[model samples]
Target: MNTKVSRVYPRSLTFGDTTVELATMTAADAPALAEFVKTLPVHDRLFVRRDVSHPKVLDAWIGALAQGHVTSLVARDGATMVGCTAIVVDPLSWSSHVGELRVLVAPAWRGRGLGRALIQENFALALGLHLSKLTVQMTVDQRAAIAVFEELGFRAEAVLRDHVKDHDGQAHDLALLSHDVAEVQSRLRMFGVDDALQH
Candidate 1:
């Protein structure tokens, strides 16, 4: 399939026993999203700053895309909610074609290639929207997340010390990684649409 058409069209994908489907969040998904976060471990929770006490957290995330500021993707396996990815695309005087990429995979689902699939799918979605760049945060503690981002062809752009808040409310540095959209798409095509966990 040609890159544009293949990626622009959304299709259901399967990986192992997991059937991954994509959808924009609605008010109805708020409950599932809340539930999804409640089940996450502390380490995983910090990535997205989970806080039900703050209703605005869900409000801004679920509505960011429709609000024309960001794109959010929810991944599901059967009826079980697995993970969510949020892509922030904001306009800037320097460059409006780039979209910021941020993602979090459920801790239990980590190591099963779910993160890669979610990222690639999200990347394609962002590209279909005409974005040409994607950026992600890389904290010193998140070695695994860093590896995944690097493997996906993201390059380290900068390191901002004390850039994020920890679970205990401590600040830490965040490594910024970026990838050219065209390069990421080409790499995923070479890597194929599915990984071994699927077979």
Candidate 2:
């Protein structure tokens, strides 16, 4: 269960006809990552936990990456970032064994299987980190995302009514989904899918 020995980054994957490079996020990615976040639609921005559109907020995220509080993967098509993910954890907190998963894909990349790839990557990451549980929350309107997560074995956990606010101050409900990483790993081991998850 040595994560450092098992997980490797700076990999490549093909979604549809597009080839993308997935790498661990670094300070050098700030510029391109900033531009990518800016291109996200308002609706997409609404669900992000922080206002990543702001330079300071985005900078803080980069700092977190260096501090190891957040482990992220940035998916790039050439020089442009098409998708990204964050597995946030607080080792000092009571729920240290749990990680909150956040994923964002550009509008053009949706429905092309990039998100699924990212999710699967994060699943391996969570397992490597020894996380027993993983959770993801998104606006209720994101039915497609919910479906993808569910298909990957996440189940409904809870709903936070009027949890998020839009620019116009409208409220939106957030649906939280969780995956039991321990249970999944056990099942995968039982089914002999352990080797397949590594790649």
Candidate 3:
């Protein structure tokens, strides 16, 4: 589980008036990331895959990033964290061609297209890792997230009825969306992002 620190990370992308710096997650960022997650609204926190408010869970995520089990990227506006995204590739040989994407954006940053930018970054990383497909699971009511993925060629592949329960014990259906890497590449080419793919 030796992790290689990526030198090509910490790149910058601009969204309207904001300039976001994206970087690979590392052990040193665990505390900061945890703090950032704490600022999320309670409803948003309920959907996060890990209990980021808990120190142990946050530590575990840091360890996973350090071990290369997850490829994570964080977006920062100046010194403040605004968003984070990751792709987890299965170690099992049978599922090696597929990866799962996760994203969390600060409430204030939601409508500014940062989420879409993060997804684009994930796609590039997935391509570089040679993954053939990517999947994302979200509650069916997340229309904004669904729309963003759909715009990028991801389609709903499955829906699990009442798959998740919120803090109030209310169940919610989960929708799983998937994208074929080849199709994503084609879409990017259509958008004149072929230059990005070449890197």
Candidate 4:
């Protein structure tokens, strides 16, 4: 219930020039994490279903985060949560081998290659859990997010035209993309990220 509980992550994960120490979500990080969710773009925010907190969703989400089924990783620049990502491992038998990924970067961290690192880490985590696939989406306004997925070897699997109606009743298309973890690992090797990069 105290921030001290999550003040430091018990494990360390590498991310470029920095190491993202990870702590399972605790009540303390709730407020900051919740505030971060508010910063996400409308369409992006809509896709995330925070199931853990009760009256307020992020609180529930934080509780779910402590469970391996839905893991959250926050990147820190000394105490500031500069970036965050979630790997939602599906628990149903039908979706047991798949996980959905959502990543967000604080405005200041954009274009610094952190997004790729966050994704790569999530992919590795997904694979470790024996997941068969990772799914994600981007709306028309998110060109950069789209490019990141493509560069990561995710193919645009579907386009749901006018799938979502805005407040004005104008339909917006959503691009669905997916990546095979094994394939992405193979592709990264061809692109210059060898084993040493993992360290």
Provide C-alpha RMSD values for all models, in order: 5.3, 1.8, 3.0, 6.1
Q: Any runs in candidate 3 off by more than 4 Å, and if so which?
A: 1-7, 186-195
Which residue pairs show backbone clashes in model 3? none
Candidates by lDDT, descending order: 2, 3, 1, 4
Candidate 2 lDDT by residue in tens digits, 1-199: 2224246878999976778999999999999989899778888876678778889989999998887778899999999999999988888899988989999999988888899999999998888888899999989998988999999999999999999998899999999999999898999899998767665
User: Which pairs clash in the backbone of model 4?
Assistant: 52-60, 53-59, 53-60, 53-61
- Model 1: weakest 10-residue lDDT segment is 1-10
State TM-scores per candidate: 0.79, 0.93, 0.87, 0.74
Q: Rank the candidates by TM-score, best first.
A: 2, 3, 1, 4
Residue runs of model 4 more than 4 Å from their true location after superposition:
1-24, 43-55, 165-170, 184-199
Candidate 2 vs 3: which has more TM-score: 2
Q: Pick the candidate with the highest lDDT.
A: 2
Candidate 1 regions with alpha-carbon error over 4 angstroms: 1-10, 47-53, 92-94, 183-199
Write model 1 residue lDDT over 84-183, tens digit each, in one string. Answer: 7777765644666777776766677778888898887776666566677888875668887888989978888998888678658888777788889866
Which prediction has the highest TM-score against the true structure? 2
Write the number of the candidate with greater lDDT, choosing between 2 and 3. 2
Worst 10 residues of 2 by lDDT: 1-10
> How does candidate 4 fare on TM-score?
0.74
